[model samples]
Target chain A: MPSIKQIARNEAASSRFVSGHSLCRGCGIPVVVRTVLNSIEAPVVVINATGCLEVATTRYPHTTWQVPWLHIAFENAAAAASGVETAYKALVKRGRLPDEPIVFVVFGGDGGTYDIGLQALSGALERGHRFLYVCYDNEAYMNTGIQRSSATPFAANTTTSPAGKQSFGKLQKRKDLTAIVVAHHIPYAAQASISHWQDLSDKVVAATRLASPSFINVLSTCPLGWGLEPNQTVRFARLATETRYWPLYEVIEGHYRITEQPLDPSLPIRAWLEDQVRFKHLFQHEDAEVLARIQREVDRDWNNLKRRSEADAQWFARHSERLAKEWTGSAARPAPAMTSRTNTNP
Target chain B: MPLKAPKIAPSARMRLLTGAEAAAHAMRQINPDVVSVYPITPQTPIIQTFAKFVADGETDTEIINVESEHSAMSAAVGAAQAGARTMTATASQGLALMIEIVYIAASMRLPIVMAVGNRALSGPINIHCDHADSMLARDSGMVQILTENAQEAYDLMVMAPRLAEHPEVMLPVLVSQDGFTITHSAEPVSLLPDEEVRRFVGDYRIPYPLLAGEVVTQGPFAMPDYYFEIKAQQVRAMRAAAQVFDELSEAYQACSGRRYQAVEGYRLDDADRALILMGSSAGTAKEVVDELRAKGEKVGLAQVRLFRPFPAAALREMLTGVGAVAVLDRALSFGGTAPLFAEVAAGLFGQTVSLSSQVYGLGGRELFPEQIAAVFHDLESTEGLEQPRFIGLRG
Candidate 1:
């Protein structure tokens, strides 16, 4: 069996898109996108939701995309991709497209996936399209200049939800998109961070293999949007996971499994919060009680997730075996019989 | 042996179909891949018909009933970007509500086609024929096409997506039909055969970036470094749509044996005075022009078909040698001149023509043929109408 490093190296070597068409320096979105793209070998069509990713990559007449990329309106990437995927499947069934498994993925920012695009995403997931949706969660509406999104962390400074004398930045906690996706009872759902490149790539690869809808909520970093130095993107992302501020986990067939357990006596949530300008006001105000409340909330959520993971161990083990069997069986089987229908216009 | 091109009726018997029905017929002929629709009259019937078609499995198209006009356009942009021919319809307040995202759709160049039931912008709240809703979207980089009657409304709807998705013209198209005048008014319209339309328009071939399996970046964040150039590209695409419009219209005429010009002229060949108008008001003005000609008066009419590229050169050529032109505008510009009239006057600048503009039919007040005829008579008698006069204003 190949090691994880060997697997990553092979995937990287076969990267479909060329490097550098103009993303901001150290942007985590492109990194996650590239890793995801490299992990899959199928013919991939990407539907990009309106947000930082769409705004950063495509400028008309000149683009950095090396594969079929579409920039649809914000809030409908899932619906749009469902159309594409549906068309592709229908065409394949009719022998219009080649009899090969194709990958249809929708890439959305936090605002597009968790806020405005949520309804469409929910519909697509419920409809059960064989597609993967990747939500690059940078926590705020970063493309529109650090505006507050539903995924924006509690007590964090954003343009619309600013922390002032009367208030702390955002009063609400970050939306649980993973829970939302899992609620749809999709075959697979995972939470990942850009800092863990290998883990992210593995999750994407696993997601594409599922027969039902799969979602990967990636914790992406935005230096400019978050008011941090460019070089600290990866470091901040790592700290987030380490402190259990952004836990890494996966849900499969209604079962939760912790992919990366935070070490005993996890780092204080304050350490992760103080790293960015968004939480600076909380530190300056000496709001110990607010900080304590945030810490307690994180601790409670982490403990709950940990307990669920422990309870679902047997289910996940069985799921892993079934997945392995399916993968091996698919590999052994010949390609599905090609349909005789001709797509060519007479 | 080469297979002969499929033949259909030269012109089917014209039937009076509502503007909504006309739009529905056009959508049925095109058979787009997806129609992301949220119903708002006088635009609801169009989507309703489309939804019925999808449900009946008459057309192999996806019908998504979204939450709002915002979501409708959003879904359209998404579907179109995913390389599917997609469209939606909205009107008046709905259009105004979607103003911001509409601009984004244009800048993104998603090739989305929308039908706007031209209605009044709100203040005291009214829903009737006026160009204010669409006029507010003038700078959104969409190829705005105004239809004068049910026939033009139907023809333009079929022609719009083709022009919008052209490689050189990958911008959205707005097919505006007056809210009540055309949208609700039933008029005889020739529905083109689906095969003929498919032959004329051909399959939508999105150029470089948007096709499936091609990783092309779209709608990227354009900072100070790239925003201006991206805008310039959008402008270039809109300008390029002019030639495509002409090409498509000619092909459409060849296929259906009926023709539509970018600017339709009625009795303007040997006339000294003419009336310029857009949308359904053109139908009224044309009637007025014919009546004046029968009365031994030399008056004609020019109707604007394509509004986005403005058809400035075409208007200038059509209006040349005509001694005077009165532009009847159905929408107000507020604090400035009438929107369509302002564009016309700007086009005719430096040309030897006595020009005047009048704002009428504000908030869906009817502009009858007699009212237009009265305006023409006023223009004939007066040297220059100093300011735009409202014909149907109540004191």
Candidate 2:
């Protein structure tokens, strides 16, 4: 496995996703995109669902992609990727295509993945296609102008669910799509923030190499939508994980592994929310109830994840070899016989 | 490992097969590189039987078991755009769900062939036989063809790839047959030799494939500067298909000894009156025409084999010298005239011949010889046909 720094260096030599697109300067989506794409070593084909990442990257004739890229519709990236992977298998099997181990990756924003694209994502996961589905979760429909998405956190003010006069921001709680994705029982499901480059980079590496389907939800930042200073984006990203609002953990083959357990438990959630104007109303008024509820939801989610992680630790200690075997390589895994054709070149 | 192509039959031989079976057999011979499919009633056999072939090692095609018709076409768009000869099957509600991607497939210029078991769309949800499913797809920019029997279904399936993947005509194609009426009904259909069918279709090649080392973008968002030019490609492709299909049909005729025309004018060459429609119902109309012809009546029948691309030129030429024509449709446009009637009216807008239309066999309503003969009679007795009338409709 290459280090995150090594991945960047190799990409600088020959990058698959070239730089200089139209994503916002402080936006975390491009960071997430570059990191995830840079981690993969082999040739890749990218399928994107419509969002800020997609619309900003390729605005017709001016594409940021150096490899084969496709954007069909807003909600079928995973479904389309399934077709591309299937095409690779068929062509290679028929000896019309050279047998090369190319990887398939899809990038979708929170609106695309957590909302409109959930069905296609679920279907692709259930079918167990060999690909990586990365969701740059910036909490709302940023490309469509900051409308509330299912991934938007509780009490986060959005255009659709505003925080004005009588309303106290969004009334409903955020959906835990990562948990729903883990329910599919795929090989890997992880949650990482853009502030944590190493964790995000490592997850991307593991996801791209896995023989089965893998999903990683990166908590990207949208400065314009979140109403934060461009330079303060990464700072808020780190504060989010520190406050346990965005826990860094991964589930591998049903085992919960907490990758980042903050040593200090006193990082107030306000530190993460105060800088963003989307949450400014919560600070302007003495809304302790809303603040307390946000903290309660964050702590409750973190505790539940911890309970699963602690229990998983003991179980893994007893069966570490079995767990390691599941991850070391796909050799022991029971993969479907995808094709009868073998590499003639090999 | 190179797959040994299936042994050729040398000459066309007749064998009993269902519409679904014939389609699968054609797929087996074509040996497409990829097939993404999901099962729906009336259309399931095409995919399931094809799956059996893949399982039994009769062919090396990769069959993707998708979750829904939408994904099936979505995957097909991906596969075909990536330079694989891809195909799938759907019908009725499945076709409705996939109709969006069907249009996208054509607009993107992905030459995917989809086999549709024509069934009625929802509302009371009865599914037996109708042209409603195929009707919904007529305006989707795909080259649509309907089969009269198992042989036409088999032959069209074999020809779909050739028409769609032609460099001059890169568009998706839909081959349809009525639901249970033709899909489940068995008939003696002749098939060409496997190698011969393969040689006719040739290998699918796209100039700008998503794979093959050359970096290319597909399904790009065209702005005003180039949107019209990009859309004109479909127009150009459709026109090219109108000619390609004709030439391919002639070539197929030489091989099978059965010449097929885009518009099969059965007994209509010198007739004074005609009944025009498509699908298996054409056969029913032909039976009536035969009886009417034996009685010294100057009635004939014209079946639309190539529905999409309309074949207006051939239709105008076929309808020439005829005094009156009655157009029958199995699918109603609702709040308007029946779909086929509208197209036929548009096809012969300025012609002097009197034209009439009637909606028949909706939601799998059967059309008997008497009802069809009534339509021919209505054409003869009536003068200056205006609005469409519903035949055999409940009062």
Candidate 3:
């Protein structure tokens, strides 16, 4: 077997994308996309939702992607990808696409995945398309000038949900998308952050190997949208996971497993809050109680995950053989390839 | 000696089918790769029949059940842009909801064909024949075709994809049939043979900008510098559609033994006054025209078929010797004049024809043949009328 370093070097040299495109400097989304595409060896079709990913890469006549990329509307990337995957399966069944196995993937921002595109995503998952969905969670609607989205953090000031004399930024809690995907009882669902590149790459590769729908919610940092220095994208993302403001974990076959644990039990939330203008209002107001309340919520959520991970690990070990048998039986059959000849004229 | 009337071919069978079923049958014949649809009243049967066809294994098309009309059009646009022929159906409030992306579909030139079961606009709640929904989308860069009955509804739909996908006319087509009048009514309509339609329409050829290995841009934001040029190109494309329409109609006539035109005339050859109308009301006017002609009254009717391209030159030539014209529209333009009436007056701008515009039959109220004939009476009584008039309204 080839060493990991050799594989990484080979992928870097043979990348389909070239340097110097219009994407913002240190934008975390392109990094995540490049890493995921580099890991897949099969022929892949990417369906992109209407958001930052689409606007930056496809500026009208110019496109940055060398692969077969489709830019559908804002809310139906999942549905469109479902159609593509269905067509591919029908074609393959008729002995088309015989050259190799093909993979289907969808990419979207939080506004697209957690809010507008949620219905299509839920339907696609329920229909069980053998594909992976990656949500590049940049917190707010970054491409539209940093507006508040359902994924915006609590007490963070955004354009739509500004903190003023009577307001403390966004009062609503961020939606738990990972848990929502797990409720569908899919085969694999994971949450990762840009801070851990190696772990993010490994999870992407593993998710694609599954026979059912798999979801990965990636915490991509937006230097411009988050109001930080352009080069501090990775640093901000690391602080997010380190402070337990965000968590990294996976749910496999109705079981939850925490991939990382916070090292400090009583870390001050102010450290994570002080980096950008979105949280500057809290510091200006000197509202310690509000800050303390948010910290408690984060801590409580993290502890619950730790407990569930332990229970899930125990259950999986106890019934490993039986679960394996059930999985083998329930996994979807390999879809046949689609070809022009199979599309008969009605 | 009169020219021999075209013989009706015996092999061409006619079946009584609703407008919705006719549209569904036409779509089945087109054999689109994907169809994304949502269920709304008046437009639901189109999808229900399509769903049945897919389930019965009668057609091999992928049907996506979307949550809303907005997503349905979005999905169809995406599929069409991805090199697949795609279609959807909606009406009334559903069409109103999809107003935003409908414009986008046309600007992108995706060659999408939609059937709008024309219904009354809201406020007091009505769901019958009216042109409110489709008239609202007049300037959205779509080729708008209005049908008179179930037969025209079916025939227009089969011709829609061909008109929309023409290389010079790469624009979306909106085939509008009166909501309950035609959509729910069953009538005998001759179905076109599938091979004849395929041969007439041919395959969709997207311009070089969108094809594989071609570096071209589509639907980009036209800044002040480029916006004018892009819009100018769209205007030119709309004008080019007239030629495509004529060519296809000629070809369809040769193959199927029936002919259609942008404007249909009824007994207008020797008439001093003509009532202009659109949609199913033309059927009622046709009856009135025949009755009045038998009574030796110098009255006739002219039905406007294509609304978007307006067919200005055709209407001008058709109305050359006419003394006075009365325009009847089923939709209200609020403070302004009626939509079809306004288009007619504008089409005959430089011509020397006296015109009277009237707004009536709004909210799907009953439009009697006598009510339409009253417009002719109003034109005759008031010589050189100064402004447009409204019929069937309380004092």
Candidate 4:
């Protein structure tokens, strides 16, 4: 129920992820985490994957997390969150727990979500756990020295996929994880960028308020790993979204909705690629083919999303009976606790 | 539906059930808040039957059918930390997948109880009876107890939560039975009233829970400064498990007229030779001991019930009057002696008795009474025990 401005102002007074941890000076992960956490209207239990957020926030006795938090291993954040949600249901149904609902949320990195943890995440969603999973896609294994994950871009340089004389960095294009998540047929799944705080915040609130598994993928910036000046983190994120490289969008039920359109006379894809050191080699080598390929992939993805979002307003209305009949298990469970209406944003 | 008569007289009642069924029955009695499990060979019956219990309104336990054992244990850790009385079951590769989080559950001091059906590890992938699975987690800091029969499986499982939830010992407990050998076979087990069972395991009170409005950080990134201290907390809890188990078992015995000890001694008094083993194989060893005693061979047997927190002093005391001892293990250590053999050697490092080791029952190979008697005879015949022997193995 909180507006974006009100949530930000309230968080400014008392931060859930406190300062003084050793994350990079302008890292976008904290911004994404804080923004997502502020949108929830209930007491939250945060489960974090093993990444910059987990390692830097909690170092032995000192922890920056003011909320109740847990970090167990790298890939089981979703699996662990399923436990919390299931436990909550079992206790509440048995009258051992209070009636108040506590939101279950997970913070996983791109490496954890797109690679090692895909099975667990898929399983939790398929089982219809009532929780929210946010993948802070910094695009590589930044915590373990920037290895190339499936989330890493095709031509981006990483420790594992370094650009050399004979070869370009990361030959394969990044996986369309949002599409893969939508294939699970959960109620809500979205693609947002940390630079678009309002879009990401709205997606988090919508995802957590539902009683089915929900996922949001945010393009979080990593200064140390992405080779950017500490101050240029937000600029890089903004450029990525403006160039249509990372679109601000959401998928509620089966329909896609774009939250922000690119600005008039938007910046070129080169502007998005030129600032970060991960892509500096592309400029130095003047690899026209790689740049064109990257642009082509982005445009194809954006056009696909635009077509889906521009569908008639009655898309769900036409398919509502089938969606209900298709899933009779937890997918179709009655959610009395989620009092708010479903996100039918056009 | 018309029923003619009650199966049992009012004075006493018993029913035939497999090891898995006994475990499921115990779960119903305990009525855990959450149960997360995956289906694997020799362990499928347990979760399947428990799911039926939930469907039939026998218990209000929430049964989560997870994708794999890794998630099964992972979910249990999260639920236990969230202050729910959680339980789970797995075996072999399933158990192997769960070892990482098993250690985490113990470290966090979450008193979750797991029932493991002992099956062999892979390579050839045989799904039968063996102790290889349970031995994989011997040092994971969880309290592991071996059961000798379906009756023992039920009794031990019912008592596990008490030991696990004790204030002094808040580590996880694993109640293991040999796969197929105990899990598939049926035996008569006495039933306890659900009301009595409920009173036995009262409310669970966690010191700090995730959703309890109190700010608590779990599974913290421990640096060098406090890693050892946090680990020592688990160690202290593990060490306190033996006493806690003993007290609870005595209390349970007062309610039901069955007694269980950390290490059960069978005919060990004034014996010249003996055999020591764990799990269902001990039943064969005890039978072999009785047959040897009938022949006046002066033989005895020792069954290890509590393997972790080892009960080293009690185990050593059980073998006091015996001469040569044969330590039996169903799993191999490859480069070293088997786990039980190693623990036994460490327990009696300076003792004067001649010690022998045997590795048997790998991949569910049949163990017989004769093989156990042979071990006792071999211990008596040999001048001094040296090389490790393989029981019932082809030459």
Candidate 5:
């Protein structure tokens, strides 16, 4: 894992993402974008879906990007990235271009990733394109004025799903996009948050090292949409993870591995929901059931993730013992190659 | 700008090929770096034949089997911006789905080439021939070309990349063949050599490739102040595409014996009456013109090969000697004037040519030579021809 100082030094040497244009003052997206871009060593090309990060960073006649960046539409970032990757492969294969290594990265907001872009994302992953897709999930359609999206949490007050009479804000739970990506059987997929910069950076490094598709659904807090103070962006982000609303874990070659355990596993989910105005209605007496439902859902999901990760550890242990016996039993054969698809996460 | 002539002219070989196979053969010859396509009715055979070429190691193309037409075009845009010679194919509903990215591909100035099997848009779900698909994308900033037969489809596919990649006209080009009529019809097409096509297309290099080390931003969101100027650039590029198409066709004529023009006129020089149309239906009109000329009737046919950039000057020039003209459209504009009729009317605005609009062949309705003869016969006496006429409709 790269330390904060090392990341800062690498970013200083070559700032792939620079500070300019109109991203909000305490936006968590830039940190996620910068860390992911800086963590990868190869030449990187970014394909961005039309959203807050894309619109804000790349206003015409001025751009904050210091690397090759492309934005096609609201729901086709993965498709666009697949194109660029395929082009690179074709050019290199035909000797039209030199065989240089490039990491193609796609950044889409929650609305673009979990909703409209879901089919495109699934297709790209299934095709096994050597790219990294990062969903900077800020929950709702922040760029489109805080409209309700599939990633919006239950009882969240979005413009489309407001907390009015006969309404307890949003009627459903947030979509588990990271798990959806993992179900594609990609080499690596993770649930990361911008609050843990080192874990996010490490996952990016791991994801880019493999020559197959990988994904990371990063929880990036939106200050404007969340109706929280700009300074509380990272605080809210950390609170969510600590409260188990968003857990830090990864799936490597179908094996679940927890990257960070919450400092207080017994922390109530209300601590994370009470401060953000989107969930303000959940605190009201009339919406008490919605808050209880949210807390129960979070606890159930966290426990399920923990059990899966434990099962993965046990499965690896048994597999390793069997491999050891096979290796000892045969003199002419060596241990099998540790390919991404076959290797167990340590 | 003229391309440098090769040392030896390309020798052509005759092959019995359908319009789709001819297009696939052109793609095989050009050997674009990337091809991303989805399967539609008439367009399927084009991609299917190209897939066979790829499977046989006949062409060096990275063909992406995208999930939808939207992704197919989106991928083409990405591949083109990445400095790869890219191509894709689609039809009616597929074109409709891909139109959004098609506009983006043009606005970004990516020289991507697309082959469209012209099919009618569906409410009742018809899968036959019409110009509704390509005409639907008329104002999308792509330079549109319609082919009259398998030979033209093959030839236009070969010539499209050069026109699209011209520095002054870096826009997407749509080479359309009338679905089923041309796409499913087999005809003898003269093909150029593979090496010659490779030399013709040459190498494609964008100033700022996404994979290149240099960083550049593409497809940026422009505010009101910059949006108009950016759109004006697309308009200028599209206007320049008209001259570039002529130059490319001339260059192509040098390699292959076949010559092409934006407006192809058949026996229109000495005629007092003419029929103006586009796509494979022009073939039927041409046959009718020849039969009429055999009887000393002063009737001619003018085919609009290039539909976009309107080619108003060339079209107006084609009708200079003709006193009356019948504009035949294969697609309707619903509650308004037919698309081709509107273009012809706008193109011949200042001229004194009496004009009549004739709509036919919707939902793959067969357009016979006699119906075309009737249209020419209608032009013989240009009286009370104000309302648009629907031909062959049993009302």
Candidate 6:
């Protein structure tokens, strides 16, 4: 993991993502994008879904990206990455391109990852494409305005799920997207936050090293949508992990490891929710029942993660070598056969 | 280790192949860097045959059997932008689903080739021969080529990538074959030598390819100030495709001994009445033209090989001296004039020719010789043809 000083060095040495763009002041997306891009050692080709980062960064005749970047639509970033990765394989195999280490990265928002793009992402993962899919989970569709996405938390007010006499806010709990990615049995999947820069950086590096698909769901802050002061972006992101509302952990080859153990595991989930204006109605109405329900859900989720990590640690200790062998062996075995016809016409 | 080219040259051979299989053979010869596809009826066999080629180690192409046609086209776009030769295939609903990205592929200037097994769009959920699928993507900015038979399907599939990858015309190409009629029906197809085809396509290299050492941004968002200009560049490319298609078809004819043109006229010289259409129905119409000509009716047929650029000039030139013209359309445009008829009307707006529109073969409704002959007979009177006539319908 790179320290803040080292991250600054990396940024200076290779300014892959530049600073001038139209993203809201102090938006957490740039932090996530810059950190993720700077963390990788190899050349990267980024596939972005149409969202705040893509639309804002690369408006025609202007671009903040210094590295190769592609944006197709609001959804299908993973599918696009799958294509780039496959093309690299096909080209290198045929000697049309030099065989060099190139990392394929996908940047998608919560709406693109957890909602419309789910099928494309799932298909790419199942096909076992070597790429890293990073979802900047801002909890709502910030680009199209504060629409309630599947990643939006329970009772969090959004434009689509606005609080009213008939409704409190969004009715459903946020989907456990990291767990869903892990369920695909990919080589690596993790839950990260922009606040924990080192953890997110380490996960990006690790995810890119895998020979198969990997996913990282990073909790990104939206100062405008979440109704926070420009400077409070990192503070709220840290609150998310500290309150155990969004735990920091990773699953590697089915082995779970808790990357960050919150200093105060018993911290109230309200610590994360109370600061955001989206959740202000819950406090104003003195909705004790809703607040308690949120707490219970967080507690249950945190406990489940901790239990899985502990169980996985014991099993992995004995089977680490075998698991590593089986994973890498399956990836390397049966290399696709290459055949070509005679060039009589040439 | 460098791959050594085999000394033995592959020879051209005539083979009885389904249109889908013919497309597969064309793909096999092209041996593109990547092919992404999903299984849709009529279009399925094309990829299925290609999959066997990959499995049998005949080609080293990276085959991605995507979950949906949307992903298939999406992956193809990505691969193309990443500087690989890419292709895909789909049918009606599949084409409908994939059309969004197809538009993007054109706008982004990725030379991805897609094979569309033309089928009717659903409501009654019919899966049969019709132009509804490709017609849905009529304005998508991709080049649309309609094939008359399995032979044309093979020949055009071989030519599509080269046309798409043309430096001046880097747009996606949709080479369509009528569903069931050509895709499933077997016919004698003359395949060019594999090496000849490999040389014809050459290597696909593009400027500012992704992962090409230098970083480049593609598919960027365009604001109002710059969006129209960017679209104008695409318009120029489509215009360039018309001439490029002719140049390529002539080049292909030189080697394959099979000539192709944007619009092919069958005995239109000094004819009084002409029928114009596209796709497999041209075969049926040609036979009707022959039957009518023997009886001294002076009838002719104009088949459109390229539909996207509309081939208006060649079509109008062929129908210039003809007195009466009937435009047959396989797909309906509902409340509007049929798509082909609209184009024909627009093309011949000031021409001194009497025009009529005929709609037929919806959801693979049979288009027989008699029906085509009736369309010719209807052209004689040229009355009550203002409202698009539906042929072979029991009124």
Each candidate's DockQ: 0.28, 0.58, 0.22, 0.70, 0.76, 0.68
lDDT of 2 by residue, B1-395 (tens): 12222122334487878999999999999999999999998999998889999999988898888888888989899898887999999999999988888888989888999999998888879877788888888888999999888778999999999999888988899999888878898877788889989898998898788888778877766677887887887888898889999898899888777667889888877899998899988877777888889899989988998988888888888889998998888888778888878888898989988888878888888888898888888877666477678888899
TM-score of 4: 0.94
Per-residue lDDT of model 1, residues B197-297, tens digit only? 76766676565434444456655555678789889999899889989999988887886676778788889898888888888777667667777788899
Rank by lDDT, descending?
A: 6, 5, 4, 2, 1, 3
> Which candidate tops DockQ?
5
Candidate 6 ranges beyond 4 A from true positions: A319-346, B1-12
Candidate 1 residue-wise lDDT, A119-217, digit = tens: 888877887877889999999988878999999988889999999989988999988989999999997899999887766766776677766789999
Model 5 regions lying over 4 Å from their true place? A316-346, B1-12
Candidate 3: TM-score of chain A is 0.89
Docking class of 2: medium
lDDT of 5 by residue, A204-227 (tens): 876776678989999999999999
Q: Which of the two, 2 or 4, has more lDDT? A: 4
Model 3 TM-score is 0.89
1 against 5, candidate with superior DockQ: 5
> Mind sharing the TM-score for model 1?
0.83
Encode model 3's per-residue lDDT on A38-97: one tens digit a residue.
656555667788888787776645667666676657887787676566545433443433
| Candidate 4 Cα lDDT to native | 0.85
lDDT of each: 0.78, 0.84, 0.76, 0.85, 0.87, 0.88
Higher-scoring candidate on lDDT, 5 or 6: 6
- The sequence of per-residue lDDT tens digits that candidate 6 reaches over residues B136-249 is 899999999999998899999999998999999999999999999999998778888899999888889878898687879999999899989888998999999999999999
Q: Name the 10 consecutive residues with the lowest summed lDDT in model 2 chain A.
A: A337-346
- Model 4, A199-241: lDDT tens digits are 7776776676666899999999988878998888888888888
Model 4: per-residue lDDT, tens digit, B1-395?
11122122233658888999999999999999999999999998888888999999999998888888999999998899888999999999999999999988888898999998999999699998888999889999999999998888998999999889999999999999899999999877787888888888888888888878777788889888999999888888988998898898899999877788989888989988888889998877766776778889898888999999898899788888677889999999988998998999999888878889899989999887767767777886666568988877887
TM-score, B chain alone, candidates in order: 0.94, 0.95, 0.93, 0.96, 0.96, 0.96
Model 3, span B1-395: residue lDDT tens: 12222133445567778988888888887767778788877878888987888888777777778767776776676667655667889888888877767787877777889988888878767777688899878988889999888878878888889899988888889998888778888877788887776676676556532223333333444356766777787898899888888887888788777777888888888788898889988888888777777789888888888888888788878877888898888888878888888888888898777888877777777777777667777767656565767677788
Model 4 - which docking category?
Answer: medium
Best by lDDT: 6
